[model samples]
Target: MLTEEEKNAGLVGRIIPINIEEQMKTAYIDYSMSVIVSRALPDVRDGLKPVHRRILYDMSAELNLSSDKPTRKSARIVGDVLGKFHPHGDSSVYDAMVRLAQEWSMRYPLVDGQGNFGSMDGDSPAAMRYTEARMKKITDEVMADIEKETIDWTLNFDDTIPEPTVLPTKIPLLLVNGASGIAVGMATNMAPHNLCEVVDACCAYIDNPEIECEELLQYVKGPDFPTGGLIYGYDGVREALLTGRGRVMMRARTEIEHTASGRECIVITEIPYMVNKAEMIKKIADLINDKKIEGISYINDESDRNGLRIIIILKQDAVASVVLNTLYKNTPLQTSFAVNNIALVKGRPMLLNLRELIRHFVEHRHDVVVRRTRFDLRKAEERLHIVQGLLIAQDNIDEIVHIIRSSQTPDAAKERMMERFGLSDLQSAAIIDMRLRALTGLERGKLDAEREELEKRIAYFREVLASRDEQMRVIREELIEMKEKYGDERRTEIIYASEEFNPEDFYADEDMVITMSHMGYIKRTPLAEYRTQHRGGVGVKGSATRDEDFIEHIYVASMHATMMFFTEKGRCYWLKVYDIPEGTRSSKGRAIQNLI
Candidate 1:
């Protein structure tokens, strides 16, 4: 007889047979799909994942947390979301909320958080109970008109409440906010773009649906990171925009400033997005310690609320450019964001290029406009019916008064008015319910004016619904409005970047013992390797040379210190200790003539 576990695994009475290998493969695939769809990837429409969407919706709709509303404790919002909609851990919900609030993280932060959210130094945000959060004004645009039935809705995880499948965003949030995620066998990292640049590019694409990515590049140069940095590799950006994938190099913007002591300091006022200032300093210190980089004498993070300032003091006459370049090469000061524009498109994951992304946004805008217009039209028509009834009652003031006074009940008066005025049941009800003050001259005139404006607006909405060009015009106008209000200068700058850079940078400026041979051979070995011994102990041989060549001279210097050389011809030349051929204590050195 099989064990209980084996019996359960294998075919038993009323049990179905299946291959274990196939089941494992299928289960893993299913789990991967679930993670990719529900956890990692964002929707192309709103540029938000399930958890993010739930938090925003719960905050905005359920909690009535608008941009102007008083901020509520993050713990409350997190708890509500976890209990009602998301059904996820409190940390995940709070983290998503925190990222939405962090200006360093999101190009356009959705949440207006009070108290400490976090810092660019990669500090953790305050506890949920400690922080307060509310929606930002622009997030209104993201969740705009959602209540007007502009987008599809889905039941929550528990099937108790309905939630929007995607937000009815006014702008192309995908480009504006960007996204980053890593899933099984795949990952996505979309760099944020400038609001103005993105809007202009979107409008350009709208004008010419066949517009190439290069043409769009005219409007949108490259990624506009929230934490401003100097972007290089324009070609890489263009390729990413065109093909949905490429790597754009980012270098921290730094200025070489003169300190009080007249020493030149590399002041890093800005850095690449997501680089922690504290960790970056530690990394540079590590590089200096490990003999991987040279010339940095001291590093201090003088960052404050005013702005980020990481001061890297250099040695006297140290090549600032070389030191900066070395820092860029070895640290997070220079980084590359790999653009993989993957997002969920209509419940399926898809990689979209620039034009496709713009087109999706424009299409969503058009759909939203249509739904909004219809909803508005229905509301205006209903109000128009009530207003028309009021106007009719105002016109027949005597008859309405007589009918109301003669009837014993309100229902009898409503029936009599409907029969006499040829009004619909709703119109008759409005007439019977009319306030006495509404019959005044001012009220009648206000009603007439409202009626005229409603008719005019209703006609315009119909026209917009009828023509695609008109719809596009509205999109263009709104984009321009958004640009005028929210758009600012692009933070990240793109320049032509050469791919090839020196691989070998300066190492630690460590003390070393230099030795030369009569044959003009030279070598350097660490000074520490020469051990101190009793007077009777012979000095350690620091170099190996040819039989005919003996050690003529030795000097103690740092690896980065300059070495002056005088030839027999009375000519002088200089070389750094690192420039000399490095050799072990027993290794013969190479000829200096070959090195120079």
Candidate 2:
């Protein structure tokens, strides 16, 4: 088809319309793939992405591996990584490095960088090349294994650089201290766990591969965030671990403190993880500025080099309970972390249940063990074959010497021995190499012993290979049992599991006074005070004054409303005072009415 404009210009233009829906879908798919590959997917061992892993590796390579040392300028490390391995700009890399080193940011720091890598006070780090960098020992050890081919590798965008597909983590990092990331349509926010508990769980799995998830829970109770808040309920933790989706509640710590100035203050020591310190401080300041709080003189952040010490100074007469309640009602002091994502097997995005993640890791480890064992077995078999050949030629020293001196290669010598002795390849290779002259007299026995050891190892390898499936099945069954026992969905709210108690002495005396009034104000008077002040009233007897006078008090629950009024004359009336003008006095009258 051709448009009118094409006809006017004496040219024909074909019109091929595109399906907008199809185009949009294609674009979205591309975007999602980009996010999944570039942003998420923690390397199994190091538990970090390309950029994060590179930053740590570069820091370790440049800075001294000690947090105790004076911190290196962060800029220096950023420059090294960007210039060498990571092609990203200095600013982005530096920001990420600073975040990792900042204690307030990450639950567990992968880099122990020193200097002003920024502060929890919303401070940014200095420029790249100015701030020095160093790696934490944990990062160093983890990355060191990378060079040993413990993990797979893939090419970079240009295929000029090689990057690890995933790290060969010796530990179950997913549970040790969990991870969080957002990629494409998926995101991850696993909670940090207790180190001791995780180690125990891993050891349990190893000892009895058939251990159930429920049994494992006995060792690992629940996620233990570094922030040290109560888990409230374990159901969410269990669900997230099991199915990789749940929520958990967290609350800030607050306490009442008596200041040296003879006034009270509310002190906040710890905050929830990832809570913005600057924003929180500003919010509190706004509350004070608005006069929403009573008797709050000032708010100060005494949080210094020592630690976090947010002090809310109160007026000398302010009620502490009211102040505390106001804080809870107003701020992000209490929040919840929603966990609903998973990262596993490098680039493969799996919706992991707690049991599923553990199973995946176990499977990977099993593969590694099998591959290592096979490699070991192959080398041992080769050595055993050579020893067998030497054993067969033990009596023919001259012939063996002739074969060795005459043959041009190890294989050639073995072949000649095999034909001359009418022996198998293994026997021929063993005899050709087992000559005492092949080693000094002292080492000859040692060589023979090594030959026997190699033969035994080969036999063992064959036996293990034959029983591999049965062993793996046993391990898998044990892990499944552990998961069943401990893996459960989190019920975030608190649960109290006990019967209610009723006690005879539960009731206490009520010191409260109740009054019935038709007006907004009800007056109360103490007898002793009234007697002392109104002793000379007309028509009042001396004994009457002592009995009837009371201290003056008023209770006004609300203004402009009908009130029920009760009087000393043993009368009651309902007064409609909602329209009564302020400062007006009512006639002193008493009336009584009874319902029919």
Candidate 3:
């Protein structure tokens, strides 16, 4: 509604008409793009979201929290981040910071924390005020040559300070540490990989950018989780590497042990990635209380700082393999990790497969190396110019000293030196600022040696900048150096087969004799228990039976062989030889009806 006076002033048409639907569509898209590009997804180059990048930058650049320095309070770090770069809540920033330090979360922890960060049992970390953190030694690689202007910078939230758009990390952090996040209508869930494997793959890619994903797989077998579990098969890993999306089955590492009381127990040493230990134990307890699983007698979590250990005691009559399989079927001990490698590339979300990921990292390193070399080359040239000026002064020491003494002011002396030697302002100033001791014989020799080294470096830097091959060689060398410094063995194991696990796979095949009596008693005894003896030795008892129920049937079969039973009432039952009750030569056996 326009006012009458405004209408008289011919302002009636100021309120332009537009479709409400169109406005909403436009606004919603704008907001969605904001979340997708600016907040959620990690940049493919550095493998970090905005908040993570901001925190690292503030710690490294603003606070100088290097690995060698004393740790600073996490609250102080969060405060600086919120005030300078990120304007979000303090909790979000603190959580991200804590994750960087938690070994369970990060394949290679970026921050070295001095207090409790978190645990695999899903415990929350202490408050920011109670914790202290400094950057890890590996994190120094991320901030390497940052001051050399190897990457772009953008203004912070309030435009008061500038921050890096992406870290010029030397390593393929995207693959080495992985990333996960959710944004408008899209999400990313990448799995961490072994540093050595990733570095090897990266070097191979730099040698040949046309390398296929299959070749890359030879280097990186699969995701090497920080928690160290077993990956059931490689098919999902292959698919994810080729197409950037797939799910891999993960199972806890366990072994069967016989207790002193003759009962069997299953011992779990490591669990799947990101699964909470305490919650998993609780789920197992609930399943037991609900009678969903019956073989276990009790469960105990004996995990400690040394490693993860969970003991599950089984009943005397329980089959260890069956109970273990049941647990896997019903509990988080067996889980699937979906790999969706979506990340930001040039401010747009893109799904990156293995080769694309390697290519992006190589290209980024190429850029950083070029920029760093150029920066170094410039500084070297500037120093070379000043050194040339000094060498000239040394050669004409008497004349130079005479000019300085004759000039009325330092400004006049600089002008006269520049005019006489055809030197630039920088070189002239260097000559004017030179100390008397710098003109000594030893100092002059050092100046000559430095100039010669600078010349060689300048030439090499120029060659690297002009030749792509040289740049790649440099990238390869740096990756190898980093690998030698930090690479370690893969913790997670990958099985090549895709078949579902069968409980029978855990059993061994052996010759056994099955004996049955007229009273429906059945038992299996290993053939080895009846070894041939000398003529004077007595034979072992074949079966202990009642006088009314003598042995009526005897059969020999392998432990894995299946047996079918037929009754006169037209009923049939089948069982594996290993599943039959085992008894000593003099012991009575279990009833056949109970097993069948």
RMSD of each: 6.6, 9.6, 6.9
* Candidate 2 residue lDDT tens string, 1-596: 98888785774345657899999999999888877777666644346777786776555544454444565667666666776677867777877777777766554566776556777667777665656656554454345444444466676656766666655544455665577788877787877665556555665666676777777767766666554544545666666666678876555677888988779888877766666777888887888888765567888788877777788888876667666656655665666678764675656776766555566666665654455456668878777766655555554666778988899999998788777877787676556545455645555576689888887888877665668664465445534444453333321223323222222112122112222234223322222222334656563221111234332333343322345656678777664332222221222111123210
Per-residue lDDT, model 1, residue 515, is 88
lDDT of 1 by residue, 1-596 (tens): 88999977776577768999999999999999998998999888788898888998998999989998999999999999998888877888998999999999999889999988988777888898898999999888888899897999889888999998888888788998999999888888888999999999988987888888778878888889999988867878888999999988888999999889999899999999878888989999999889787777899989888998889999885778779878887799998888999998887889998888888888888888889888998999999999999999999999899999999998999889888999988998888778899979999999999999999999998999899899889888988888887888998877776665643344656789898888888889888788988889887766777778888988999877888888789999998888887789998888889877
Alpha-carbon TM-score of each model against the true structure: 0.86, 0.65, 0.85
lDDT of 3 by residue, 433-482 (tens): 99999878999999999989989988988998899899899999999999
Cα displacement (angstroms), candidate 2, residue 392, comes to 12
lDDT of each: 0.87, 0.60, 0.91
Candidate 3 to truth, TM:
0.85
By lDDT, who's the top model here?
3
Clashes of each: 0, 61, 0
Better of 1 and 3 by lDDT: 3
Q: Could you give the candidate ranking by TM-score, starting with the highest?
A: 1, 3, 2
